[model samples]
Target: MPSLSPSSGQSGLSGRTPPSPSEALTVYVVDDEELIRTSLQGLLRSMQLDVRTFGSAEEFLAAPKVAGPACLVLDVRLRGESGLAFQQSLAHRGLAHLPVIIMTGHGDVAMTVQAMKAGARDFLEKPFRQQEMIDAVIGALEADTRRLAAERSLDELRSCWADLTPREREVLGHVAAGRMNKQIAGDMGIAEITAKIHRGQGMRKMRSRSVADLVLKMQALDVIRRAA
Candidate 1:
């Protein structure tokens, strides 16, 4: 609505502690009304969030996708497209990670239920309290932060798994099975000390600090999931 104003909120958010790199969050507001978008952007920027406003859902969708903790503030009624249907369609298109908080000037019970079922994180009627909107935005950002963190951890785990040698993977499987070094050595016809070396190498490669941690990480990476 504000034509995607590009201020970094430095002026708007002076005297406030800046968010750390990892703590920075974004909010996408898609409302056709200029006044509504301007108001929402001001409020969010004051809270030190990176705010981007769109005059239409299409404009927001056209923007390059951001892979961080972000939320979409979508109005229920939009130009040509119904926001509820758009939310469902977005999920269908595999964008279930971008959480939505629906807002409307003329909301009804049916619309609220439909929005909730479509995975809308929160619903707010027009003329909503600033605190209510802030709460919803905070909740959505927290959810996205957790989701992104889990995804990053899984990706790192997979990368570590990929770095392992075949022998390391084999040793990991035995470790996950709760086999002692001597038992693993017997199963593989190797010396117990060799088995221990291989096991230690695998654990290091997996970045695991403990046997239990290694087992859970391998299970998550599916490196020894079947054994687990």
Candidate 2:
């Protein structure tokens, strides 16, 4: 298997329209065979895409991690690590946002079902047309873009929460849990006037003008519940 960098074999993609700056996507190919790897690399390049290829799962993982919008075209049968196992490992390492399109010459109904259940973006049998691979790559890239956007939105929500004072944070939690000002005061053992003040401060800092807005923001930030 040959290890091709992103810069090599990219000329063929000259005619293919590239995504806008805000939409550019990276497509990575991982396979154990040199021919298959290069073939996919060329195919994607011909479409004016940014493509990279790795000889094995380990090689792919060892490469510098990319945080921008991207997707993977992975083979199910690798020399050392099975594609399914690698997918699981990516999930365990918190890299599941990188959408995977699993390809195999030995695909079965059961294996395809398992791949989908494991969060694969798509599964294609070997001997697929170039167009099929291209479509899958495009779909996976779009999914990754949406996922990254959602993460950014959540991060902003967390930052908004972080700006709150301790008392405001306490009030935020109470409000998010459906507590009225009077109930929140009772729970905090504070005067209703004080509770109202804290709640208003928290709402302002969180940029939430209403109770529903506060609840939605908290849910988006994944702060409503702890993992027990």
Candidate 3:
């Protein structure tokens, strides 16, 4: 896996600010057993990982969070909530993008299936090798980073779309739907030349380099709904 640390000299060369410690990847552990929590926390800290441990699902949920790439190392059984069920609850509350790795002492095939179906990124039985946990945690964090980046891109696409003029927006929709300039002008009750101008302006404002690119950006904004 790639290192989470910012590359050396990147900030110097690009004049961008370096990432702070709070932006480093974190591993959040939630297990009811005090010994287990401390032991795992010690292990992760030894690896230079930022680790936070909670005694229960409710406690973990209530804790203030850091904004960065992170994953939950969750044990299956808790004081008041089962990990699998809590996974479902996370999805219900729109926090499902948070990755979870389930660990348990009494896991079975059915439980494994349920956890996976409920959105667990990985599972490990108690007493597993340390390397296994480390690898799973790294993979889970990467998955979450990708999800967050996608959402950020979608938000930016929506913002750019919001800046289009009404006529430019209409021409964009037509072009995205594969309408020719002449056909778009006929349908929109404008001359072909005027339609061409609006189409060029829309493409520039949308920052799209091709019809395919424009289509994808607009799709991210659900512009098809407005076009329909």
* Each model's Cα RMSD: 5.2, 5.8, 7.7
Per-residue CA lDDT of model 1 for 170-217, tens digit only, reads 988898888899999999999999999999999998888788999888
Q: Tens digits of per-residue lDDT for model 2 on 6-88?
A: 33354423333434546556888888899988888777877767788999987887887667788898999999989988987
Report the Cα lDDT for candidate 3. Answer: 0.80
lDDT of 3 at 9: 50
Clashing pairs in 3: none
- Using all chains and alpha carbons, the TM-scores for the candidates as numbered come to 0.86, 0.76, 0.82
Model 3: per-residue Cα lDDT at residue 98: 87
In order, what lDDT does every prediction score? 0.83, 0.81, 0.80
lDDT ranking from best candidate downward: 1, 2, 3
Predict model 1's lDDT versus the native: 0.83
- Which candidate would rank higher by TM-score, 2 or 3? 3
Candidate 3 deviant stretches above 4 angstroms: 1-22, 225-228
From the highest TM-score down, the ranking of the candidates is 1, 3, 2
Candidate achieving the largest lDDT: 1
